[model samples]
Target: MSLAAAPFTSLPTPLPAPERTKTRLLELIKRHGPQTAQDLAYKLEVSVPAARRHLCDLQDGGLIESRTERPGGRGRPQHVFALTDQGEASFPKTYSGLCVDVLRHVQQLFGQGAVMQVFDARSAEIAARLQAEVPLSAPLPVRVQAFVRVLCEMGFDAVLEQDGDTWLVSKRNCPNLTVARQFQELCVSELTMYQTLLGVPMTRETRIACGQSTCLYRIGP
Candidate 1:
């Protein structure tokens, strides 16, 4: 046997960037909250009309919905777009579907700590990504906004609101709500990530895994 001819493990073929972008759009809506055509354009680095046309296509396919924003100020009402439930379903979530069964098996073979260790690893990865994107020294609101932006990028539909000394962070969808419901550890890890990323104490008031309409959090609690 020629030791020099080492066996190579095959890697999963990557999806084309264009195809990836289709799903990415769904994720962007899921995490970033609703976005305008202009916002999508900037994110996609495409022309405004092109982005509008693409969003229209997604809308026509029943993957997205466009609603006129309540005018806070200025000229025409901007049309904000968000993912429909169907759109949220189109994103890649192969693990969540079988999370309960998988975790149960893992617990049988190893221990519950193994399942939690898995969640902790995932949370650490997400936290590191967010930390790199948003500095901890930035102002609190900006950090919150940065966290929301990161959530959007990760495919969450996240928004930030301020009331007095508290900042309300809400996510409209959970990519892995099924797994989160089966294993609350996932939820805990995500909350820990949020606390780390935003650098402020937060309390989770609502959880989609718990049948809430949104995952609502109050910062500075």
Candidate 2:
């Protein structure tokens, strides 16, 4: 008998539907990991069978895995699914995770408390640094530019416009504004600190009518 050659196996390829489903599923998994099929279906806004079909595709693609979970008094155990290493790689990169990574590095450099203290010190240091750059006799517009630049450094998209000797500093974007609204006291404090540093007698008022999507700080002389 002649010996037959072994058949070559092809690598798994992700289909378009499976790819789209996997992308969304990975996002959900990153937000809430180790979910059951029913939970994933609800979160993804798809039917249970549809969710299962996508999940099966992802499993075959090596992007996710499932494990059995048994609750008390259950006839059969449920399978909880989560992203594989390959799955996490499919999602967008997050800077918050990088921030934590930096914190870990700082902890290594100094200590855990030192990292905390550094965070505390940063606001004051930032204020002082900006103060040093402001010219005492500069025009109001120039001073406003300096202030907005400092705010931008702190990850706020701030812009300044002058109208009749008054400066309006609008916060166009703030990545943390949604979660930090509860800490509005901190936001006001930082704004006050910058105003003091600039030696500008600008009255500060905030508008929260637009919800967290938009917040405004009206600074006027």
Candidate of highest lDDT: 1
lDDT of 1 by residue, 1-221 (tens): 55687799999999986566666677778888888888878898888887777777789999999998755656788889998888877767676667788888988899989998888898998788668777899998778888889888877899989989999988998878778888999999888988888788999999988888999999986
Question: In model 1, what is the error at residue 3, expressed in angstroms?
Answer: 84
- Model 2: lDDT equals 0.70
Q: TM-score for all predictions?
A: 0.58, 0.42
Model 1 clash pairs are: 30-156, 30-157, 31-152, 31-156, 31-157, 31-158, 32-152
Give all candidate RMSDs, comma-separated.
19.2, 19.5
RMSD of 1: 19.2
> How do the residues 142-175 of candidate 2 rate in per-residue lDDT, one tens digit apiece?
7778767877876677777767757677776766
Question: Model 1's lDDT to the true fold?
Answer: 0.84
Query: Which stretches of candidate 2 lie above 4 Å from their native place?
Result: 1-122, 207-213
